[model samples]
Target: MNFKGLFRHFTDMKHYFVVVLVVFAISFYLGWANSDRYSFFLEGQLQGLKSVSQSLSAKGNPQIWYFIFIFLNNAVKSVLIIFLGLFFGVLPLYMLVANGMILGYVLSLQTNESTLSVVLKGILPHGIIEIPVILIACAYGLKVGMLVWKMGGQLFLPVERRTARRELANVFRLSKTLIVAIVALLLLAAIIESTLTYWLVHL
Candidate 1:
């Protein structure tokens, strides 16, 4: 992979990163303050996560199996979010908000620092890598939507061939770079979650 190119693209797309941060912060505050109001909506999500945890605990799986599971699970979700941005960026936005709200609700459930610490330890080991990777995917996904919109405009103005070509090239390069970074980060995140994170939480 061309590291320099990837770095250039990331720097060029700083606005999207800002978007992710802003959305996450807004939704997190909402989840923290209004969790009770959205309890019905969040119930399913909470239950699903609970069920996954329970199943893992029940099976007592080997580390390798856990790693594989985490990687595939997260990879699927991440890719879906990235591709869903094709929907004029709405789907990706919804997912970002949903995840932030769920996290906020979870954080709100804890009454004390001890509980929060435990949760943070369990998540942070992998989350440090995972969260940024996810956000990057989201940012690139949103970029796809914007490019698509530009391409649409270009369709109506074939005279702007040079501009259209530039947009197309950018879209291709950005997608490739995001895919490489996300895959590598998710793999590392899976390893950490299945090993260091799992042990830390269990201990």
Candidate 2:
């Protein structure tokens, strides 16, 4: 409800900064290093569409598939984010960095002579909001895990056995709120990337 509360929640969960950096760096390097491969990935998808030209729907208003496609993309990204959080130590970084590499290598197919054009025309539009949101959510997840670990697996009550059954409802609430916000941003990016970009590119 309040901006301060939201900021507090976000800042309180900064433990995942390392993981976020690693993932972003890898993704950026791969995407920017070989834009050709990225183009190829898109071309391949086009080729698939070309093959499936049996229906006239492909030529129709793509606005119809907007939500469906973006939902799926955001879902996949969310999975990656959550997966990274689960393995937050060296393993998570390895996996996250690998993802960046793969993305970079794949997106390299797009043949844009100018680096700025590639970023501006291809990624920066939606990535502006989505990427940060993803990182924020992942950071929260990492923070929660770290907090749980630091508290000796007792995030909510005294370790002693003689205590009343108290509630630790706050932790769950914060997690849910953070997760929902992240998802909103991700879907926002996906929708923009899919709908607007798709429209502009096909022009």
Candidate 3:
């Protein structure tokens, strides 16, 4: 893989990444501030997640099961959002908000534990990598959404169509490299979450 090229490609999408980050931040803040109002919805989501975790843990080798589940869940969703961004980028943006809100709600529920301790022990270990990968994937999806919009607008304009087409091609090429990198990082994050994070949280 052309690591340098991939890095350059990622840097080129900094604006989209910033937009995703800002949206996620705002959604997180909203979720945190309105935790009481959204408790019913958010708690249900958490319960669903808990159920899945419990089911996975019921099987032997819980750590392995956890790692596989987390990695596949994240990897598949990330890749899907990237391609599904073709639908005017709405799905990716919604996912960003949903994930951010869920995280915020989870943190707000930690009244008994110090928030810092929870973050440092339970989240930061894997989130440092997983969060950024998800953001990058969403950013690329947003890029694709923009290109689709542009392509539609320029359908009748030959010169603009050619430019948009070329840009779309380039985005797809970079996305292949990005997806590979995302999966690899997510695998590492899942490993950390399933073992190190779990151990730390239980302690």
Candidate 4:
């Protein structure tokens, strides 16, 4: 593996999330955005947990909540990876980074005393895998984005007719390999999120 290449590509990922930041801006402007989205989402899942502590009120079944939470985390992570790869040129990275910003913003807004518990037990467990998955996808996205910016539509045309055919062939190869690798990484993250995150958190 070209660790240097990988690092360089990933480092470029910061540029990609300009889109993510934009997304947060828009989401914040729209009604869908709120600091309480996290709390509301988590609350919906924990309805049954309140049975455990009626006075203080825990919510949901611990085990089910664990599975559901981790599953959603990785599912979104995978989608972000694919989006970044397909969109290329920092759009992917921006989407992923924007997600991080939203998380930070939302968490910071939490006024509850149990906010730490929600983060530690619910989020951190799977975030270990989830966050890395986003970063790796962003790495690949950065490389593709840079290549697109540098090459632009030149990959479609060639120096000559013969070169055009050769260029298209090369494009196909790059596209196939990149898509497969991105999807594989996303899948791996999803799996680890499902199994490891669940067991670790619930235990």
Query: Best by TM-score, which number?
Result: 3
Each model's C-alpha lDDT?
0.80, 0.56, 0.89, 0.52
Candidate 2 weakest ten by summed lDDT = 161-170
Ranked by lDDT, the better of candidates 1 and 3 is: 3
lDDT of 4 by residue, 1-203 (tens): 34444445444456545544455446434322444655464344345444433532244454445445545655565545544554545576565545555565545555654667757765675566556555555554555555555455565665563443453344334544544554565555556555665565556
lDDT of 2 by residue, 1-203 (tens): 34456667556445467667766686768665755666565455456545543342465655556555556656565545543544433343444454465546545545644655666766677868866665665555455444444554454655563121121234455555555666677777878877776666556
Kindly give the stretch of ten consecutive residues in candidate 1 with the minimal lDDT sum: 159-168
TM-score, cand. 1 = 0.88
Flag regions of model 3 displaced more than 4 Å.
Answer: none
TM-score, prediction 4: 0.46
Best by lDDT: 3
TM-score of each: 0.88, 0.63, 0.95, 0.46
Candidate 3 global TM-score? 0.95
Candidate 1: residue 14 Cα off by (Å): 0.4
lDDT for residue 73 in candidate 1, whole number 0-100: 83
Clashing pairs in 1: none
